[model samples]
Target: MTDFITRFAPSPTGPLHLGHAYSAILAHDMARAANGQFLLRIEDTDLQRSKPEWDALIRQDLTWLGLHWDGPVLRQSMQLTSYDTYLAQLAARDLLYPCSCSRADIRAALTAPQEGHPHEVYPGTCKQRLMSDRKPGDALRLHLDRALALLTDDFPRFVETGEAHKGTHQIDPSQAHTQIGDVVLSRKGEDIVAYFLASAIDDARQDITHVIRGEDLFDFTAIQVILLTLLNLPVPTYHHHRLIRDDHGKRLAKRDDARAIATYRAEGKTPADIRAMIGL
Candidate 1:
């Protein structure tokens, strides 16, 4: 088998900030320490928000941080056909259906309040809808109930490290059914790939063995794990690292221009300074 392969996939919707630098450095450090390969993936799946200039800036920022990736950089936008293939495969199995619910409709249907979660839970309004009954401008959603059944009967339980949960963790089939309901595989504006679909497919295609990312995505991991199981894709070990937060305890965002890597580089901050800043 190939050595451990880890990747740093950043959405090029905006400039790289301090949080991006910390996550990239951590992944690169781990890959280097294992004598494995570190890869770069441009997660420009959100075409409406992604920009060519930001993508170029991301490459430049990582290079300036003294982190070099192995092999050619992968771009999600260029892999739409591959995502489509997997989407079709899932649809053929009757594991996916089209939903006509809009954001406002979903929000209005949310009966219960969020319980310590960032976003309100989806009420599965479209879970039982027939694909043929839906019209265009509808989003594609996976059938989480059927997916859990296939996973529980066909595959053994899998576990991975989680930063939020303190150690190794496994997804209980029952909990997955309750918590994840049905998630979007693609949206109306997006062709046939949403973040959950594209991310799971990309990791499988790239043969990623370890996924090192920020803690904010810890909850989202469950959804991706479900997708991996449904698609019969290998589940890579995950390492959700600590996030870099500002003085207000808010996580760094692309809008935090003061924390942009370009600003730091232009201000004569060396690579060592960045390491120190992020406590690497």
Candidate 2:
């Protein structure tokens, strides 16, 4: 058996902000402390937003912060074939269906007030439709009901080692169906692979034993756990650390260039300064 393996996956959509630094440093330290391997994965799945320059800057920023990854950095762009294979497998099991609804359509369909969540819960407009029934531009969605039925009485659960919520949480299918809804596995055009699908598959493919990321993603872990279970992939322990927010208590985004590590570097802030800023 291998030692604990973890990864720091970042999209190259923009500059590496302080939040990125904190997460990367945390993942690196954890792997180093355990004498395990820390891997870097470039989540460049969004072909429209992801840029090669940003990808290069990500590496440079991590290295500047004294965080080094083991092995060659895994680029998601190079693994489209693998993603296709997994998607096909899910389709073969009848766990996936074609979704033709747009964001406007879903919002218009869901007339009832929704609870506060990070993402908008998708209304099941295309749940009954199969791939054959889909039009040319239809996207793919997971049949949540059918997928959960596969578990039957044995619902999926995962261990959370993060400070905020640490325990084995049971995934209630009823709550998931209503709250989470049927998430999109692919878009109408351009890149076919979705964030959840790609990350889940990559984690299993790299034999990642632990996933250390921001707490914003904590709520969505259940969805990924479900997908992993459906695909017969090994689920890893999760540690979602506290997020770094601005003065307004808003989570740092890639566009927060003022708080970006590169900007800090330009201002002659040392690595220790960054560590102090993010409370690492």
Candidate 3:
């Protein structure tokens, strides 16, 4: 068995901000402390927004910040075939269906107020959609109800090591259906795979024993666990760390160019300074 393995996955939709450094450093620190491996994944799934220069800068920033990941970095763009294979397996089990609902369509369809723990979930307007009826612009959504049933009543659960919400949390099937709802695996024809699907598959593929990321993503662990369970892959321990926010208390974003790692580097901030800035 592996001692400890975790990953730092960032989408290259934009620059690596302070938040990215914190998560990457934390994962790298934990992996090294355990005498284990830390992996890096460039989640370049959004073909339109993801840019080559940003991908290059991500590596440069991480290297400048002194975070070293083991093995070759996994680029999601090159793994489309693998994701498709997993999609095929899920479709074979009859757990996937085509959904044609748009954001506006779902909003109009929901008469009752939604729980929306993080955001609104799909109201299953396309729950009855058949693969045969799938049109050119239909997204492939997992039949969460059917998928949950395959897990045989023992709903997905995980151990959280983050300081904020550390505990053993299990998914309530009802909550997952109503709150989480159907997760997208693939979108609009075969052009893209969803973040939830790709990350779940990559985490398992890279043998990531622990997932160290920001606390904002803590709530979404359920979907990952569910996907891993359905794929018959081992689920990893999760550690969601605190977010590095700006003066306004807003979490850092790629648009926060002032807080980007490259910005700090160009400002002559040392690696130690970077550590101090994010309170590593």
The model with the greatest lDDT is: 2
Candidate 1, residues 1-280: lDDT per residue as tens digits?
5678999998887899889899999999999999999999998766767799999999999998999999999998887777877877888888888777775543222211122335444577777887776676677778877777776655444445654666555667666666556777775554546677788788999999998888777666787877787678998888878889999888787888999999999999998999999999
- Which is the better candidate, 1 or 2, if ranked by TM-score? 2
- Model 3: lDDT equals 0.81
* lDDT, candidates in the order shown: 0.78, 0.84, 0.81
lDDT of 3 by residue, 150-227 (tens): 887687789998999899999778778776688777775446778788888888888889999888777778888999
Clashing pairs in 1: none
Q: Give the TM-score of candidate 2.
A: 0.93
Q: What's the candidate order when arranged by decreasing TM-score?
A: 2, 3, 1
Q: In model 1, where is the ten-residue run with the lowest total lDDT?
A: 107-116
lDDT sort, best first: 2, 3, 1
Q: How close is every model to the real structure, measured as TM-score?
A: 0.90, 0.93, 0.92
Higher-TM-score candidate of 2 and 3: 2
Task: Choose the strongest candidate by TM-score.
Answer: 2
Q: 182 in model 3: Cα distance from truth in Å?
A: 1.0
Clashing pairs in 3: none
